[model samples]
Target chain A: MAVTTLEPTTGTVPTRRGPDSPRRRKVRRQAWLFMGLAHVLTLKQYLVGAFFAVLELLFLISLPQIVTNLANLVTLGEPALDVPVKERPNSLFMLVDGVITIALILLFVAVYYVSVRSALTQERAWPPDEPTPPRRRLRDTITGAAFPVLGLAPTVVLLIFFVVVPLVFSTLVAFTNYSAPDHIPPAKTIDWVGLDTFVYMFGGSATWTAALARVFTWTIVWALAATVTCYFGGMLIAVLLTENRFRVTPLLRAIFILPYAIPSVVSLLYWQNALNGAFGTVNRTLLALGLIDSPIPWLSDAWLAKFTVVTINLWAGFPYFMLLIIGTMTSISKDVLEAAEVDGASKVSRFRHIVLPLVMYQTAPLMILSFAHNLNNFGAIFFLTGGDPAVADTTTTGAGGTDIMVSWIYKLTITLLKYNQASVLAVMIFVVLAPFAIFQFQRTKSYREGEL
Target chain B: MSDVVVRRINTAAVAIIFTVVAIAVLWPVVHLVSAAFTPGRSMANMPVIPFSNGFTTEHFEYLFTQTDYLRWFGNTLIVATATCLGTLLFASLGAYVFSRFRFTFKRPLLMGMLILQVFPSFVGMVAIYVLLYRIGGLDTLWGLVLFYIAGNMPFMIWLVKSYVDGIPRSLDEAARIDGASNLRTYAQIIVPVARPILTFLAVTSFTAPWMDFILPKLILRSPERQTLALGLFSFVTDKNNFFTTFAAGGLLVAVPFVIFFIATQKSLIASLAGGAVKE
Candidate 1:
């Protein structure tokens, strides 16, 4: 992660000449003046800073003009208070575009600001050669900053345009009255309603509040169940396969991974059918075996549907952990286990004290990530049940028995066009899930190694 | 002698359990294969085991001839291929910069990328839909491709960056001293050494767009432009039947993916299991 090769400036020197020292600080203050600047910087470094400084000026000039134009249209071009929305025409897109452009310009300013600092530091670091012009120091700083600055520009641009812009747009959407009848743009005008939607969602109505509570509570429960079950289920299977006791280890591994290998949509769809209440192969098989009196309503009953989807999720998800844990398990040194054995540890104790901790430590971040993943796992809910057995009571909030927050958001936006409410749910998800992602990412081997 | 006897017994017991679990795991595959060849509308009579109702090529024939399956496959292939290549090109550069360089926002951006990884991009579907609608990208393949590339970038960059981090910096320094530029050193030295992780990212990025249902469902409104996931999904959802046809398509989807996954399963598991993440 070391990018630059430029030598440290005289700022790091311990002598009275150090940049932060009293006399040196006085000199550096004077150095900000045009006359003082010429003393500290070479002509070449001036050109680089001047070039970027001009670009920064351009950004500052252009961005506000766009914002000004949008502001003018919002104010001067507005229809009277009683005028219809169509007569008013929507200023939302123009406003959003202008604001985002300004943000991008500020980002540009920040990037160039750092670049200029390095250029100044470079020119200041060198020992004065007679006339105090060092072309070498100029070249070193330019080289130091050039590749990284230039290399990262494209990705940073992509991040802004795609990730940042969309994020800003979606977040802005949360506060606006952009829902069904009176809010959708172009045909209808949406104004910021502040916290009305959130208030309604949380404290306004008893039914709505209860539904929100129910969906969020179920989402947490589902995440825990999915993670815990898959973790141990995969562990059980992986441990069995790794004993050097199974003759068909390779075949067993392959078969177990099949669920993970198949495209999840395909498997989820098949299971949705296989476990069908009526003629599903699952019910058919069970009936033939005389295990059930009749077909179980696998995908319809409220509580049963949640269990059904979780079971199917386990089927599709376990192989991932199974594979991952088995990898961790096998890589455990035979010598370590034997050493534990020599210490008179039983199999269970050795596993408890040695094996499980080591593997858990390695896979802990992934386990956290997996839980977050299931939290937003849309397909598991969408395809398996489509939030079937919809709780009639929760219609005010548009959730169902099996509806996780993500799926609930999908329902609100796609099925109901309740975009405003959906945006709130989406924001809620990000708020809730971002911390887990941050925590898990900070725990990755790369992050732990301080690579970032 | 007692220990040997005990070990032998353990092996036998584990072997029997493994067989049962293996069969249970493979049950879906067996049933899918059977349904694909079963000459019927729904899987009403097709037995749980293969060949219960005998096999035929009719469902496969129907999937190819009577529907837009081929077109969906073609669209998926194009989207997946473009998404894979685009992800590699962009993600590798981002990863290399992240692995090899320090900049102003390096730490924040790294953490930001991590945060972005879990930010359900599906949340932006409405915004994306409206944006693309204005841009005339709705119902277009490139629109889906653009989103997939952007969606895959953060995770791919993080994964590849971790892999690149494990490589020694001495190689970079040596190359620099040998008169190579920073880009050259990364391109020639770091990338080659990072091939296994790169391959893993490529396979995953390729399959990600292939399996994605939501984005395609939201974007591609027309039947002709539907992806495999969308097309196959519509069979059961939009219709009351076509179980065999759905099975045929699903069976076809699993074949190449399962084989490829099994082949490269080690690299995948290694990278993901903190093996490739280690310094």
Candidate 2:
């Protein structure tokens, strides 16, 4: 404990006699390391914290230098890895990955600096102020951080490694020319073609530009159609089942929730089979009913496929709204309804005027959320249509009739192996959907108030 | 007399509408069960009543004996259990910190978490893949759990923190006065009171991976390491597919979930509403 707080006792040998000692003078100088902050811990805590900080610094140092050199390669065109390839590997991914790793390391250093700086603050008062010493004990001055650091260690580690690093890496990949053919690593070196991919995606290639316009339009349409149909359909079913004076309404509600209760993957596959172009259960039933002279192309023909996926999406999704509506309805105040009744409102009018708005009011945030959710509803699109009923114009671009932004990204990445394009598309998704998400969450007012 | 007649007609109309809607909603579930029990029933010749033919358990037998389903089931169980346990532990601890402690970075940290959750995590799939591959965790269940538990931490923290805040600090004070440390106080006093929320978290965490397809499909490579969703999906993906066997596998996957849903239906709906549509 270097900055030990010496009690200046008047009767005790003038503790000032030792004030001129070198160690004492050094302590006095270091005591004001934290000028304004209160020293909140004891000397034991300071040692424990210092020990942990050193351990953390060592851990960070071990992993960062290798990535830093790789990042340097990105900023300057050169190879950093040990492997001597016959052909040099692309450095774009290396660059992105390296920058992410270094940034994470730098972030840790900042945190450590803050921790130590705060720990070194001199105590405003300690030991009831026995004629306060010029310097404090090293052990006691290192206060306030030990227990909190120990508690927060696991969560912070996870955030840094799993969340922060990956986000940065993904963001960096968006800036390079990472698409197919020439940019792949281990075969050919990737050079930074800053904003070229963005240019092509936005306004360069006629095919690319046309595809984005078309797919983006369809994405908006699908989100709106899917969300509205499900919401209204759910509201109708919930209203009927709950309001109707039927003994079996409870049983019917349970049965209706089956679609929601089943695994979405299974339900989606089942719908796909039921809508298959050639021998679907839906076609067989239609033929049996003579509703059509010939089987309709439910999952083929670009237009029909759009309708089919949306309808099937509604089929899989309505139960969620139904469940939500029912929960809200059950909790609705009967007094309001009775008051409306006294105002001469009939049943239908009561539903139209009183009940609908209340449910909508309560569920509006969720409805907007579902719209945003539908924007990236990969399961419904992927399992049901696989983004099929391909459009001839955008086939090379990989945007199909049923493709939402998310499934389109999946196609670009996995099937086409154009990760740079996929990362760009992912960023596009965030750009488009994140604001709406934040807006809807804000509209809820609960999150804003620190309610949860 | 006229009012009575109108009321009767209204009830009848509602009954008819509800019954039709229920039947339509139940069609897929009914078909799934029917297909599972009928041996080799393809989509081409599926009867209106899928179970019109005699029932057979051959599809299930094929699943167990001819496929690595038991292994998939084991893998899913391990992953789900680990995820639930890991999420419960991490979320509770993080929530406690936010609820009880005041620090400079608390608000910003919470806000960052909320913003982070707004973007889907799959956007970072390639990045995560590279990280995991370098760290030797790419193809393992533990890797999947680490991803999921970390992914789920923010929302769960927000949820459990709100619940913790509702718990009075006086209880903690009382425990501290009784010679208890913070850890002891949290363990004995607060944790017991937060059981409902914790159980809600466990159920959701367990069920999420059970229904999920994207991450499992992206990460796992070998057939032996497949989850139920991946294994069942393989049935229809290949040439000369077995739709019946796929249905059988799907049915098996859904059975436990359906039972759990029915048992906890009320709590599930309440939690869903509270978590999603907060007021």
Candidate 3:
């Protein structure tokens, strides 16, 4: 779409000055300089020129400092005893400053590009006999450009500082020694330790490597199981409701969607309590029914807690998929199914060949997204079990049997202040998840059609 | 006769599965209501049946009288409302530009937003925490609101852009021809036409912060500033026997939330389906 919208003009301009004229070449070269068009610019045009000039001046001024910041980022900081304490080397500060500087430079380059493009446009539009007045030129550019500039500026700036900057800072944290009680800022300085954290986590120690292996494997399993179970569970419920002609179908559908309707945090927490080993309602009712003499360790056991969270996730997750599949099912034309049935396909085969393929085509991307979401489904495990009923490696690694990569990252950074390790895991999650994101994007209509 | 027999069997099978699944799904909800109304301080004493112990408003009463329930509700309301309004403002603005204008990096920027959503925001939470500390946003409600607004930007922009893309340019062009400024045309024309999707965005964004736990837990550490999720979570975890009270508080939020969700489920799903795929 942008290609269509931003195509360069190929039409010839009727120039009073000849094609090889010196004047035309001069104007073309002048378009690259700030205030170069001042001879032809009116008062309003001068103001526009002044605005871009100020931006250019700011960009020039910040260039050296940005370069210095980049240099300091590589060195982090040296504990210069000659400097005051406040001016002393803080690696965190340097890294943050470096990231900010890069964001600023990107912004400045965008502005520079816009200004130059506007200047060229102004030059091209100049008349052969009588040029457009400066006031009119100013109005034209403002109308053409100002709307997007004003509209996008706030969101763009916020994303740069908040989302992009922090991501860069975290990515950089993996290469540092910013852990607490030794390398914390303002008292102790952190130094760059390239790939050491990664090496340590993967093969550094027996406990850590084992913990990483367990959590990573479980993360993949949880993502796969959660996505598949929810998808099929919803499909079953949706098919059952749709295929059956029951008087109570609407009521059942309404009741089934309760988990989806209620906030997930509330539901997960309530389930945690209901499954309590000693005092939970599930155990209490089971005891009253004489099913078991002792309470079951629902959230206390390592393996059961994993099963409990996944099953409970089924209850919490299925309704959304049910609704989505039902939506997709409604779009399946009756003619297609009827044709399949008439071709001697039994009911099951008709569903398998016709309805299943149709529905899968529409909902598969969502299923993949669901897998990605489950990979970091912190609240599902955190609130339910707090990754508790700790396994052998939990004490050393701060990871319980149910802890996924994101939750483990939380435990490391928030509870243990292991910034270096947390960031390494964060980077690993990014690596593992990026392929799924790219795959989804490639399947999107925008990419396939080469239009947005 | 065989057809009738097969239909009967099918109906019987459907009924059996429905009963089992329905109980499995609805038991927790039923138990939550029971726990909230049962006359007890401890969940251990309560029976399984609803109203078996006789109904009492004591837990709800205790929630209001003893805990910071009202304060937490107010804080949550404030934060959710602000996040909704803020998301609406920035996302709609950014979306309008994306839909209407042809600019450099437009495609790359959109792609960047998609990629950003892939990287979990919590991974950078340490940097976020430190950033907030530097800005004096730690332990403040506004800081949480700002963070939520920033987090909602990428997806909401794409969603709202899909909606805005459908509006006929003629309407805005007509307004522009009548000497309306771009802002005026957007405010007076484009926004009203895009109301359905915007309303969907507003409702979803509002609901997000209401039950969000982790971000509020990390950012807001004060007793009085806790959101509903944080406050209710503390009820069971703290050194108190307030399981019933936790139930009471949970329902207070859940009941209204469920009602709102059900009321808007049709449009929400419709808009999501509309916005997700670009045909």
Candidate 3 per-residue lDDT, tens place, B1-279, comes to: 698999899889989999999999888998888889998876786787767888999999899999999999999999999999999998987887787777667887888887877766767877887777767898999989988888889888877886787788778777867977667777899899988878988988999898788888888987989999988888878376678898899999999978876776666556545543443
Native contact recovery (fnat) for each candidate is 0.49, 0.39, 0.51
**Where does candidate 3 chain A have its weakest 10-residue lDDT segment?**
A1-10
Q: Give model 1's TM-score versus the native structure.
A: 0.88
Candidate number that wins on TM-score, 1 or 3: 3
* DockQ of every candidate: 0.47, 0.46, 0.50
Report how far off residue A136 is in candidate 3 (Å). Answer: 4.3
lDDT of 1 by residue, A1-452 (tens): 12343312211332334345333343345334322243334434566556555665676578667677557434423424466656665645554564466566667656555554454444445454534445655454444546666666666666666676677677767777778876665665667678888888887867878888889999999998998889888888887877565455777777788999899888888888888888899988888889999889988799999898888888888898888898888778899999989999998898889989988887766777789988988988888887777787756667888999888888888888888788888788878987887685766676776655
lDDT of each: 0.76, 0.72, 0.80
Task: Compose the digit string of candidate 1's lDDT tens values, residues B174-225.
Answer: 7878877666877899889888878878888888877889999888998899
lDDT-best of 2 and 3: 3
lDDT of 3 by residue, A52-163 (tens): 6777777677778888899988888876667666777877877788888888878877776665555555544554455444345556444454667767778877788878
True contacts kept of 1: 0.49
Winner on DockQ (1 vs 2): 1
CAPRI tier for the interface of model 3: medium
